[model samples]
Structure formats: C-alpha cells, structure tokens
Target: MSRFVRQSYYRHVYGQPSKREMCFDNIKVSASAWDTNLAAANPKFLSVNYQASGGGAFLVVPLTHTGKLPDLYPLCRAHTAPVLDTSFSPFSDTLIASSGEDGKIVLTHIDEDRLTAALRLEKPEVNDLEPVLRLSGHVRKAGHVKWHPVAENVLASTSLEVKIWDVEKAACVVELPQQPDMVGSMSFNWTGTLLATTCKDKKLRIYDLRSGELTSMADSHTGIKGSRVEWMGRLDRICTTGFSKFSDRQVFVWNSGDISKGPIKQLTIDTSSGTLMPFWSDNDILFLAGKGDGNVRYYEYEADELHYLTEYKSSEPQRGMCWLPRRALNTQDCEIARAYKVTNNLVEPISFIVPRKSDSFQADIYPPALSGKPALSSSDFFAGKTAEPILVSLDNLSETAAPPIKSSLYASTPVVPGSGAVSPALPPSEPPAPRSISRAPSPVSTKHDPLPSSSPAIEQPPVSHQPPPSSIVAPSVDAHPEQRSSSSSADVDQLTKENQELKDELAEKDCVIRNLELQLEKFKTNQMKIIELSKNSLN
Candidate 1:
C-alpha cells in the first residue's frame, strides 16, 4: 500500500479505557430509540437516562461513586414518560435538565451531600428525587435539550419547534420558527449567537438565535436516517454527518458564514449502518463515533480538510456516547479529550491521551479552556448583550480566570429582534424520494429564500441574478424629460420580462450543476467502496 507521510502533534494519540473498577455498571440504559446520547457528563457528575417503570428518570452518579451500582438507587425522577434527552448546565456542576416524551423539561439540582450520604450506606433505598423547576411549552414530545454555551440560565430544547428558555424566569422567551421536519440534530456556534440544525427533511439550516430568523440553508445528505451537526470551536465552520443514498456514511464541512453556496468540503467514509456522531475539540480535532461500532475515528481538521490521524478500536460496541467538557480534561496526563461510551449495562470512560515522556503540562495540546462560567446572564443575553466565554489556563489550578480571548474569526453581530434577513415563511417542501437504494442519485433541493446581500459570499455565485438595469440606475436629473420618457412603457416591460427570464435560467442551471456535483460525489464514493471490499476479500 502506498501512503503519503505527514507530521501531526496528535498523530500518536490513543484512547485509554477505564478499568473495570472505575466503570459505572449495572444500570438500565434507555431504549427509546431516540437519536440521543442517552448520557450527559461533567467533571463532578455523570447523568444517564434510566429505564424506569412509572415515569422517566435519570441517575446522577458522582465521579467518586464509580462501581457496580445497586439494583435500586436514587434517581432524578419526575417526568411522566421516558426521558428522551438530558444535559448538564454549563455553569453549574449540580444542575441538570431532562426532556421527556411527556412534552416537559425539568431542571433538577442534585444534592451532593445527600448523594454522598446514600453512597456510604450499606443498603441504599430507592429514593425518588423531584425536579426544582418544570417547563411545559412544547406541544409534541421534546427530543433534545441543551444549555447555552456562553449564557447562564438559558436553555434550548427541540420538538416540532425549537424553544429558547430563560430558566430564571421559568418561561419560554424565544420560540423559534417551526421546523419543517423533525430536527435530527442542532448545535450552537462557539459564541452561542448562531444555531445550526440538521433536519429529517435533508436540509442544514442556520438560525440567528436573537431574532429567530432562518438565515441560510442547504441540501444535506439524502438518506432517511438521522443526521448530526457540530460547530467547530472558535471557527466559522460547521460539520455534519449523515448517510448517503447508498447507506454510506458521509461528512460535510460548511462555511457557517454562507451556507447557501453549499458545503466547502465533503468526504465519504465506510458503508456503516450506524450513524456517525461528531464531536469537536478546542484543538480543532474532530472525533467520529459510530452509533453501533466500537471504533472511533479521530482526525485533525486544518486547511479545509480532515487529516486522518488514528482510530481507537475496541471489542465492545457502544450504544451511545458523550464527550466531557474541555475544562474537565486532565492536563497533567496530556489528555486532550475524554468520551463516555454507554454499552449494554456499563458506562466506560475513554480518555484520549497524547504520549509524552515529560510530566510537565503540554501547552500545545492544552489551550486555555472555558472556565465553566457563563459570560452573560439570561436577562443580559435576551436584552441583546453579547460576550464571549471566559477562559482559564490549565497549568495553574488556583489561578484567576483568564480574560476572554478575542478573535476576529466571528463578529458579534447584533441580532435585530424582528428582522427578516432570510424569510422564515418559506414553505416546507418534502425531499424527493430516492430513485433506488443502490446507486441512483437522490434529487434533493433546498427550498429557502435567498440570504441578505450583506451576508458573506461563497465561492459559487448567488442563485438570484442582479436586478434589472432600470432598478440599478436612476434617470439623470439634467436629462430632457421627453427624452428620458421616450422609452415606451411596453419597452420597459419587455426589459423586465427578459431580466426575469434570464434569472430563472441561471437558477435552473445552478440547481442542475449542484445536483450533478452530488451525483459525481456519489459515484466516486461507490467506486471507493468497491475497491475496499475487493482488497479485504483478497487479503
């Protein structure tokens, strides 16, 4: 085999699975079949969705309480149905939220002292803990819940519609425009100002959170299975993972500033049946974990391409997985990131560690991380105040929080409360059915209004053409009135009609070209799959 050589700092990184004694075992994982991790983790606690009988419940296990948990233990139970998703508050170690099939979101504050006392007992009772706050607004079952990256007491949950909630007020502050299809996945940018979402309708949409306007959108993968999206940290980039028409897993990286022009780069992985869940690290590393596969593929994303580094292979496959926050990583061990993989009855921690001979902290691998502090309060955030997250150095444990690093990568554009930069009234068009499951091209179209002229431009030309000449220029003030008016109304109408026709032609061609590009990509992917299969057979 011929291979090109390249040097990378993370080229030799490896995953170290937790020992049996350290793993959380004997817990019933949720079987709701939702496209969620079924787990949420922080430095202090790990929350796992529990398969309860009477109501939806999740267990919050402290990091020190690792072992084979009892058959019945304390659970944060309040929901009337199975819990679909759970997320820990970024600013609070004891605060966690859960969304349930009963269309409710509950916030529970875990009492560490009570939990500690229970863990010390020889036989702990099955204690049922209730939530401190209950939010009921979604008409349909809520599928996902997430906390704002840079704001305190601000949360987001998705159902038929995505709602931004102000936890302090216990109310839904911003109800985003309804989604066309069920949202498969959504992610907030680093600044928490813009949100990127992938929907079942096979479209990737970006929304300005402040105004609740759909800014730009594009066609995504064609497979009917779920898709996932993630915003690259501190960069104006978004990455999505989904299945192609032929069931091959594919990854796409888009310029967050302009999605109308389509993905800047794309690549197809293997023909895996499981969805690839994407995770982004502060070091620009992208980790792809297959839903059903034990192996995790990690890459360094630079220069608009994903450079393959290595893969972590294991014998036991994972049902779901979640990454720990960057601030929680062990800098002494040169741990760049850590992921918790939930198997049938155990949740194991896998730490991605970089090999080093020295015991000192590796500054290159460990950058200043988010200090788990909110930059803006709920009121300030909704009042149009914007601020970046506070960062702290990993080298010093007790040092003061570092000042927020300012970067020119993304501007804090003030979101107008009621601006229609991109029309939110676009009809929800169904994606065209696949011609055949094998190798046929899927006719996917993005039915979104054109982005405002002030938006960033992509490499490709805009879909809509320039306005007619008459609209671009005004009649000279010194021109003779009769001469200026000499052009008959019929002639002006003819010019307008021609301009419209030309614009339509250009748009049609642009759509055709994009479809052709997609087809070509599919063909290439198919060829590569065949070659790989052949090589395996020969070997």
Candidate 2:
C-alpha cells in the first residue's frame, strides 16, 4: 500500500524588535476580539491596527514596504472605540472604513501631506485625524466590515444586523436584519452583487443585492462556534469551513444557485482545538486554512472535491492572519500567494510559491484587475438614489466605467428617515416563485439560538489576552522610510550575481524533482499492470 500526504513549505518570518518600539508602544491591542487586523495591505502602505485603552481610540500604523519590518511610527489615529475591524476602500487608497465597539462605523481619509507636515515640525501632539463620516446603524459593537469588490462606495458592516453603506453620501444604501440573530462571517461573490454569510444560528444565508432578497437559508456546520464562507471565484458556488455537530472541523462546497441541495461535497479536516480561518487564493481554485496550532493547511479544489496540496508550518501560532490582495503579489518572481501572520510581538510575511524554472514576467498570470479609483463619487452615488448596485466582473475590470443601474424600487420609494425600512429592489428582471426559508437550531444552547452568542472572529478565537506591560502607547513621532543603506556598487553587483546563481541552482533542483515524480508514477502504473495480468493467468 502507498500513501500520499501534503507537501510543506518554509515560512520567512518578519516583524522584529516588538511593535511597541515601532510607533504603537503606547497602545494595547484589544484582547476581547479578533476582528481587528494586525496588518492590512495596499499599494501605497501596509496598515496595522492597535487598540487603545478602554475602547476609546486606536492607531493605524502604515508601513511603506513589504518583506522587512522597520521601526516606523503609526500614520494616524482615527477611532473612538476599540476598533473591531478595518478595511481599505476598494476604489481609493487613501480612504478606509473602520467598525468599532463604540457602535460607530467611521470613514477616515489618510492625508500623506498632513502626516509629512507634522513630521517636519516634530510635533507629536498633532492629532488632526478624524472620521469624515460617522455611521451609527448597529446597536452593539460593530463586528466586521467589507467593501464591494467592484462597485463604487459600496461597503458592508456587521453588528446585531448588517448595514451596507455608501461613504460618498454618508448613508446606508441597504440594511439587512439578521432575523434577530448575530452574523458570524460574510463574503461577497465574484460579481460583487451576492453575499454569503454564516450566522450564529448555524444557517448559511445568501443575500442578492440585485434582487434585494435573502435568496436562500440552509443548514450549515451545526457546530456551536466558528464558521467562515468564501466565494469560489467566478464559479457560482461557495466553500465554508466550520465544525460539525460532533465538534469535528470540516469544509464543504455548496452550489450557490441551489443551496437547498445542501453541500455537494464535504471534507472533514481534524478535530483540532482551534477554529480554522479559511482564505481562498486570488485564482479561487486553492484554499488555505490557518489555525491556532501555527500550521496553515492548503488544498486545491476541483469539481467540488478538495485535494490536499501543502501546509505552511510554524513554531509560533498566529494570533491574526491576512493575505495581501491579488495585485500585491509579485508575479514576476513567480510568487503566487503571500500572507501576514501576526503574533504577540511580531508580524511575519509567509509566502506560498510554485516551484518553477521560469524567471520572466508572466502577464497572463497577472491579469487586469480592479483599480483604486471608483467610477462614481459619494455625491453621485446618493444622487442616483438607488440601492441597486452596479455589478462588474473581473473580465471587464479595465472598462473604467460603472454601468447605470435602473431600479424602480429606489427611484419611486422615498425612504422614511432613520427607519430601517426600504422597498425591496430585488431582481430588476422577472420574479421567481417564493420558497420556504428555515433556520437551523443552535448546537450549543437550547435557546433556539438566533445567532446571538459569538462571532467567527476568524483565524484564532477572539484573543483573550492583551499585550504585555512592556509595551506602552506614546505620542507618535514620524520616522523616515527604512531603506537599506547603500554600500559600494561593486559589493552590490557581487551579491546580485550570487543571488542569480542560487536561483538557477533551485530551478535545476525543481527539474530533477519533477522527473523523479514522473518516474514514480510510471513505476506504479507498471506494477498495477503486472498484478492484473498475473491474476488473469491464474484464473
């Protein structure tokens, strides 16, 4: 008998000398939640969040580079309560939205010029950062936020309910009630029109923005704790990771069109102690699940079945993890995937790459994608006065225009002020037959759980421990971008040559490994053939 297991890779750890010494020494990251990101990425900067004492304010530190960690200061401070989550605007690099325990979702614009002016004056007391707009829709602490992939000024945040807001107008375009339950996690489909979320009630709810309908609600993991959902690229399907009724962790694939059919396929991972945080690769065929054990497992999905490919193992478990957006990947180096893993004192960048011999740039692998500029401004979005979103796909990313969305629901009905009620703007097309919607019972409590207990919190359970006393929040002083001090050009040339030689040697080794694998498969085929022939002769 023979067995095949997953291949593992090496992780290049970053973030040294502790986050305290670097601009966030005075701030303490909240231990009560894990929704806040330790690190996030954009072309201009990498944003890091640190919690303030007593849920009053938080600092967002922006690093100018990748790979190496420097002793840099935070770029700005912009939250009143402990920020639960922060996300970059899909259309703009300077604008970002944050959800806080103070029940406010704020939009902040980072002015590089403002930061630079303060640095020039060496004024640590300069705190000019404030939310351009404060949205108060959630009754409790706002938990999670995500921007629309293609639409302009379309963003969603979760609390006891879900609110879709347009920063341009400083208004909520759509508010989704959680049916008296709390949402665990939510993900948008490829076209940015459909959303899939897991609720604390153990139900998978699908929301279609075009139709303004709940679409479908089906039974999910049935476990008591965590669940996360992700769309399978262009495929009208979603993959979810959660615990089963028996507390065994599992991953399942469902047909988004007809979730009533339930999961088409299910793969049980393990009965580990920690909940899994699932991240789908940019291409959408590969999925990685990072857990508390410091091991990140990767699998390839095809036709609803998952093939275990590899795992990124580490000695230290990750407290938080976030993958760089597709555009941030270095395709020229054949670097397919990268993630920032946040620990207690340091954050590291983990790379997942394909073993290839080619060193040339591949445009096909780096296809045209979304830009930071939105088609419509905030005023234009509100002037249109429609909850119906303009949908776009990856294939048409370069079109540079948002097609006009025509929906009678938004134009004809004037919304009642401060009321969470609006006309349903679903399916601008034909109507479909109504179907029955049911909810799954809570697996943990007998209270007929309406998703009120906990959040998926992602990656690790809501962190219960804060940073040590050694770290202290202090007034931020700007430090210049950390650059490697240049040495003599001759030494640099020698190093470059040596690096190229090492890459060539690696390519050769990869070639040899491929040949050996091919031979192994051939030998296995021959062995099977010989056994079959001998059995026939005996018969």
Residues 1-539, candidate 2, lDDT per residue (tens digit)?
55964332212222222233332222234454553344566655445566333244444444542233322233334455767777877656777777777677766667666555434444232334444445666778887888876456677898777777654334466666555566778898755667898877888989865445788989989888768888765556688889988889988888887898899788888888566777876443355545567887777554455767656676788666777766566665556667766666456666666555577665434434444544444333333323222222333334333322223212222222221122333335322221111222101111211222222221111222334443333545536323222323445566667766765674465445434644775698899999999999999
Alpha-carbon deviation at 498 in model 2, angstroms: 59
The models' CA-based lDDT, in order, is 0.78, 0.58
CA-only RMSD, every prediction: 24.1, 21.5
lDDT of 1: 0.78
Candidate 2 lDDT (Cα, 0 to 1): 0.58
lDDT of 2 at 272: 84
As a whole number from 0 to 100, the lDDT of residue 430 in candidate 1 is 27
For every model shown, the clashing-pair count is 0, 13
Q: Model 1 segments beyond 4 Å from truth?
A: 1-4, 397-539
TM-scores vs. true structure, each candidate: 0.74, 0.64
Total residue pair clashes for candidate 2: 13
